[model samples]
Target: MDLQLQGKVAIVTGASKGIGFYTALQLVKEGAHVTICARGEKYLEVAAASIKQQTGADVLAVPADVTKEQDCQAVIEKTIAHYGKLDILVNNAGTAAAHPFEQVATALWQTDLDVKLFGAIHCAKYAIPHMKQAGGGSIVNITAVLAKTPPASSLPTTVSRAAGLALTKAMSNDLGAYNIRVNAVCIGLIRSDQIEKCWQAQAPQLSWEEYSEQVGQSIPLGRIGSTEEAANVITFLVSDAASYVTGTTVNIDGGAGSAL
Candidate 1:
């Protein structure tokens, strides 16, 4: 079970809560020095404190909007300044803006793309050279199952995720020469704060249990995924355990995206 992550350095975006939060804590569990980022400086500080308290691990919380170039660069620069090297880059800063296909406005499309697609792209752009200088590194893009499944009700998220998948592949192919492995994990119905936000706005009538059940029932596993479960996959991909893995998107959906 040695993930070989001890003493390594990692960057996890949107770590204020949800999957990014879990992923950061998980890395700390494996003994990696983690730097987490999000737009809200307030939430980010609270999350950083929680991670440190929970794991007794050192954490640096950088308040940076991954969607912007300056912020992305600051994340990289700050990591190197603090940790001296960056071992893993988890592009987990994304949002859910799915609506009926016809109702998705052009502005909404642009907003989603700016945060999800360009955010990953910008992070990768800065990290590649650093990885080259450091001799190698791993980049894990946090996409979702919708990339392949393309839920009818979720259009923009799916389209943008599809682009993320492409980004993962192309980056992997191009960066493999530098010993940088780029891969993505397609998240399923993981219980997280994002779901809470959506539920509050979309299905507030359903109690959490009922809401979870409604979603989990569709999974062959008979349950929705956990933050730790998703983090395990991400950690594996970024760890030496998955050294040969790259140019791929591993679906973490509980048979939700099962191929015939």
Candidate 2:
């Protein structure tokens, strides 16, 4: 399918690696221009270069910490200065902050909210106007299945993601008149840099496939998801192909989540 995304402009946050990186790459492959942002300037630039090499498309690398409102604004401003408009925003910047409630300090909770929740808000606040000017656009929030089914020791991330779900719905209702759509994706255990770190520390003796197989045994689908799998749905959600999808979430959990 064409996706009708050629020449569209997009921004993907936390794109130095993992899902964010793959999503940005996929967008460029589909003929869309992408701006990828992250806190680490070095890695962010590397990611941009890799995307450009792979897709033969131009990609902007913005080193911004999404937790800061000013940085979020700068990202949008720079994007507009370069691309002239915005059509898609993927609020994918975040970190894993799950811990026992008693172990999580107040400071930790605040930081988690700042990055996962307010980060999305800040980006959306700046991106929405440009989207409205464009006459239509799509926004996809990257959340976790724990938002819908919180397990033990899932602290700030669960609460923050639940808030994200509410934000998605509310934004959708408000932006519908402007032809803007808002949605989210609830991710499950997926192969990512974070998971790679864990695997190296916890089970380095095993081959990568062996470790992944062991992890997959716990999931209903008998495997963990890949970054490309998650990115494919996100690309579609932000494309003209999913024009009617809004105020909703698609679970990419491989049947691991209990929520409908």
Candidate 3:
């Protein structure tokens, strides 16, 4: 049952909560030293503390906005400083705005690309060397189904995420020669903090549970997926179990995203 990940070093950007938090927890459980990052210093610290307290695993908490190149490089440097090497990189930091495409302003569109697309580029640029030093590693970019499904409201998110998928494949094509496997997972709706924020702001009249169910029913699976569910597939893609998997996107949408 060992993933052969013991002692491996990983960086999970936007790990303050949600899927990143669960992904980091799962990696630590499998014995990987994880570095978590987010923009909010206080919340990032708290997330690190909570994960450490629960798992008794080594961790580095860095407050860095993924959109900033300097912040992205700082995460890689700090991870190497603590763990001496990087074996896995999870580019998970991103934001989604549920606005119609017709209404999306130029500024909003620019912001989406800045965070989702460019952020992945910056992190991978720095992490590749450390990964190359390790003789090869895995890079998992956490994308969303909107990339394929094309959500009606979240136009910017759909476009940005689709761009991320392209980045994943392109990175895989280039990094393959170096033995660094790069892949992306097109995530479906899950119980993440960002979704919670969106729901509360949009549907203030509905209780959290009501709002969750309303969204869940729309998914083909009849419920929203758990972060752990999404992380397991991601974990497999990064682990030795998926050694041959690269330049591919595994969609975990509960059949909601029947993308042609």
Candidate 4:
């Protein structure tokens, strides 16, 4: 299906690897000019090159820590300078910092909020004006199902993600008049760098497929989701194909979470 994204300009944060990388690649595949940013310059450039090679599209690599307001502004400014205008923004930079409430330190909580919550806010704060100026645009926040169905010991990640869901709704209401759509996707058990790290740390003897199968037993889908699966939803949400979608959350959890 045509996403109607050709010639659109987009920014996907934390695109160095994992879900963010695949989201940027998918946007490029849909014919959007994408600017991908991450804290690591080396990995960000590599991701950009890969997208260019795959889609033959112009990809911009920006090195920025979304936790920093200045860095977020820089990303928006650079994208505008390079692309002339903005059409989509995917606030995908985040860290999975979950721990028992009693064991979680104040500093860890602050750091988690800084990266996951404020990061999205900063990016959206900067992107909204440009989106308004360009007449209309779409913003997709990459959240987690834990936001709605918090499990035991899922501390700051769930809290921050819940805040993101709220942000998505609030922004959609405020920006609807400008034709800027705001929405979010709640991810669950997706194959990503963090999930791979868990496999390496907990069950090194098991092959990746074996580890994923064991992990997926509890999920209704009977398997872990791929990055592409997550990205496909995100690309659609940010495209004209979903022109009327806003102020909502799509759960990409394979029936793993209880929340609707």
TM-score of each: 0.93, 0.97, 0.92, 0.96
Estimate, for each residue in 178-210, the C-alpha lDDT of model 4 and write its tens digit.
Answer: 999999999998998778989999999999889
Clashes of 2: 0
For model 4, the stretches where C-alpha displacement exceeds 4 angstroms are 201-207
Better of 3 and 4 by TM-score: 4
The alpha-carbon root-mean-square deviation between model 3 and the true structure, to one decimal in Å, is 2.3
Deviation in Å, model 4, residue 55 alpha carbon: 1.9
RMSD of each: 2.2, 1.0, 2.3, 1.3
Query: Per-residue CA lDDT of candidate 3, range 73-146, in tens?
Result: 99999999888999999999988677887999999998888889988899999999989989999999989887
lDDT order of candidates, top first: 2, 4, 1, 3
lDDT of 3: 0.88
Estimate, for each residue in 104-183, the C-alpha lDDT of model 2 and write its tens digit. Answer: 99999999999999999999999999999999999999999999989999998999999999999999999999999999
* Residue 124's lDDT in candidate 3: 92
Instruction: Report the alpha-carbon TM-score of model 3 versus the true structure.
Output: 0.92
Q: Rate residue 45 of model 1 by lDDT.
A: 92
* lDDT, candidates in the order shown: 0.89, 0.95, 0.88, 0.93
Among all windows of 10 consecutive residues in model 4, the one with the lowest summed lDDT is 49-58
Q: What range of 10 consecutive residues in model 3 has the weakest lDDT sum?
A: 251-260
Model 4 TM-score on a 0 to 1 scale: 0.96
